[model samples]
Target: MRQAEKRAIERVASKRRNKNSSSSNDEFEAEHICIRTCGRELKCGKHRCQQMCHRGPCPSCLEAIFEEISCNCGRTVLQPPQPCGTRAPECRFDCTRPRPCGHPQVAHNCHPDDLACPKCPFLVEKGCICGKKTLKNQPCWFEEPRCGLVCGKKLKCGTHSCNKLCHRPGACEDEGISGSHCQQLCGKTRSCGHLDTERCHAPYPCKEDKPCQAKTFVTCECQHRKQEVKCSATKIEPSPQRPLLKCDDECLRLQRNARLASALNIDPQTHTNDHVPYSDTTLKLYRENPQWAHIYEREFRVFAEDRAEKRLRFKPMKAHQRAFIHSLAEDFGLDSESSDPEPHRHVCLFKTPRFVSSPMKTLAQCAKICASQDSSTQQATIANDATAIPYNALLLTNPQFGLTVEELDAALRKEYAAHPTVKFHTSFLPSDEVVLKGSGTWTSQTLEASLTALKSTLQHTVRRLKLAENVFLCSVDDSLNVLRREGGQAQREGGWSAVVGRSTGRIRMPRDR
Candidate 1:
């Protein structure tokens, strides 16, 4: 047959098969040669059919609807494969858009990007940076809520304050933040009469970092000795008392001469100019006496030189001798006091109380020196005297009224003048009371009698003086009372006492008799 008749016959048969088609296969028969894709829109409005042209409805839109559905802030987003027209899941996020007032946006459901964010609803209470005032329930939009108060905080200079409004930016002295500090120069004059080379400050002294650089003339107390020193050595005006600056050997010699002249009842200048204040006869008299002021002066020199000797006691001397010794001690910068009564009166000198940096080493050296000096026969006599006392000392304490060393000495002498051999000394306690320790060759009966006499005398003295009630220092009436009250034993067999050594200027161990 011809080509035309063959084409016409195939078309007629294809139409007849389509018209009589019963299976789904016949529907796809047209799709085999169909090159056009299914362009029909699917349930997802964003994507269309992606399969080749088909005879029936397109398969469920498989062209994954990859779309980004986000909240208004873009913080929350629906990931890929999301269906078209699928509204974003309920957005539970706060708006992240920049607010005009710089405050955090309020919490709200996500909406279109074009929609404005919700207004901030937070109200805050804030204090001024200086902490002097507070703003109540300030709106969130009003950031850094500042009060009307000024920032009166002191600057680092400590002399000025930050005068800017509270809540101002940056540090108090930052130039960029319009803050300022004390810019005034220190116009105050230094001890050298030169202006201070520093800014204004609170402390009157020159700053440690910037010590006074000028030099000034410093003179001794008598103005006889002058030396140039840094202005810092001289205290700022209004406090010119600098005794240490006046410390000179010449000044000390002059002071000593003045004191000597006063003691000798001579002119100060005359005494100072004299080569020898005392004549050879007077010197011989002091040497022979052994308890004279000259002998005590020599002993005081030894005590002053010894760092270990904190205190020194001399043999009994006359009142004038003790007074001379006290004046001499003043020259040596030692504290002197006369203790004990009448014929037993003596001078005691004490070194200034100071912190010993190396007490153990000093004490060790002192012990060594004392040991080496033990070869003297006089030292042996003093040792024997201390041993003789042993524990035969009686302690008389006065609690209500304190007595000076001199007062105690006088009182003891007047009270026990009959027992002249009974040597008594006062303790070095700071209390306003006396602790008189008496030592001698005492028997049990003698000790009891002495104790009774002391009690009666003390009670009578206290009553006469009108002291406080119950002025008894220690309950020494009975041995049991003494032991129980003061934790001490008063037995004549073996009693303990804080016995002092003899007049050899050597400390000895305390002993119990």
Candidate 2:
């Protein structure tokens, strides 16, 4: 080990001297004990070993070789230089693989064959939600397009329309019966002939546990008993020909005795005096930690109801606690996400617009703030905030198609108008390729979604326009770091960098034909 270290140091010194000597008029001298690269070709045959100079035959080529690999669709290849055994590069081109849906194409990045394709993005004409008229330009993923008209189809009540967004009559079949219906009260008469105010649905008016709560007076068919009870208890049938309501246990016992007496030739009124009625009660079991669960429920309610508190972050908790909180957040209609590595990981909930706010401080900034604090506390804080102020910078470039950053920004905004949170800026790189820098506000979607959308949009646009462009996401920080290390390579190499994108006069292309 000592000899190897000495040889490495000597090799570096020798290289430095050789580089300087070559620039001057002096002859370069070789070091007697300098280490060098083991440039032997590996078993793969495509890559050479990159280990330090050593004795005997070279080991397997452990070096990661970046080479061109075909995408999943096999229509294109990306050459970003990855390891030999690494996965194939994602194709930002139209997937040539035939889709079973019969749509012209799928709107998603090219992925492995095992992965399912995303929903189709094409617009097609389909019947409105109400099945009354045809609607045009609806997304293919939509079961039925809303016609912007009232759904006048008669509901199960046979009186009022579902009055939901105008959707196809069969939309409920696809999205479940209750999923597509409106929340209007079901005004149909109940089995007891009383009006039911429950929500409108396709199922029968009342079920076992959801019996009608209205009070009504009922008497036995024998006219021997009378009582006031819930309308549902009366069990009134829609047709009047059904058996009369038996109001109480005594009445029920008497009826059973009468039926038995008729079979045995004994008077029912005389036989019923010996029987006793039975009753039942239900008991609910609580979870193991009732107090803790109550606290969680109460905190969730406070976090959900407070309008100003758009997000809630729970302290690091056990897996079950995190799961419980996730379920609790869902019940309140808030988005919940877990961050940081396990053991210190916790859940966070977000409200409307589903925006993830920017971090208050980065890792370095936090470290500086904790300079006077204990090492363990600082380390824990840093670990728990591993995702804070994460990779927010991205660069887009498509040199082959001569696409400019301005064009990329316009295409993205045009294609995905719904995501208004991200803003794109263009700049000229030292390599003469126009690069786009995209940054988002706290309200923006996740970075993964942004990257996917960017790639999918560019690929689709280029294909439609018949342009030969290949685009990929690069980090702005990476470029900046490279520039910093090279001492502003742009200026040193007589290259120029400039901000080119502006707010005025954005070029708009004609809509897809």
Q: Which 10-residue window in model 1 sums to the lowest lDDT?
A: 354-363
Q: On residues 1-513, what C-alpha lDDT tens digit does candidate 1 reach at each position?
A: 468756865786787677658555554544234446688987767678876566887666555557787776677888987655566666676555666766666666666766666656677776655567787887765556667666767765665566678666555553443223466555455554455657666445555344555544445544335455555524434233333455567667766765665687753244322233333333433444545443555575567667777667676777766666665555455556665345456665656421111121222233344445555767688655533432323344433344345654665566667566566555432222334555578764565456555656755764565442322323222231232123333323212232222224444343221
Local distance difference test, per candidate?
Answer: 0.52, 0.54
Candidate 2 stretches greater than 4 Å from native: 1-69, 73-84, 90-94, 99-123, 155-160, 167-513
> Pairing residues by index, what is the TM-score of model 1?
0.19
List the candidates' TM-scores in order.
Answer: 0.19, 0.20
Give the Cα error of residue 19 in candidate 2, in Å: 45
Model 1 sits at a Cα RMSD from the real structure of 29.0
Report clash pairs, candidate 1: 402-432, 402-433
lDDT of 1: 0.52
Local accuracy of candidate 2 as per-residue lDDT tens digits, 1-513 = 778878778778888777777776556554444267778887767787777666787665565666667777777775656555555666777666676668776556778888877788888888865667787888888884666876556654454665456655554312354463455665555665555666655465444245566544444544444344555533443433324555566656666765665688753234233221111110001144546766776676667557687557777798877766766554444567775445556676666332222222222333334443457687778654543333333333334345654565565567546556666666655443444556666533476467556666766775566443545544345344212111112111223323223213244332221
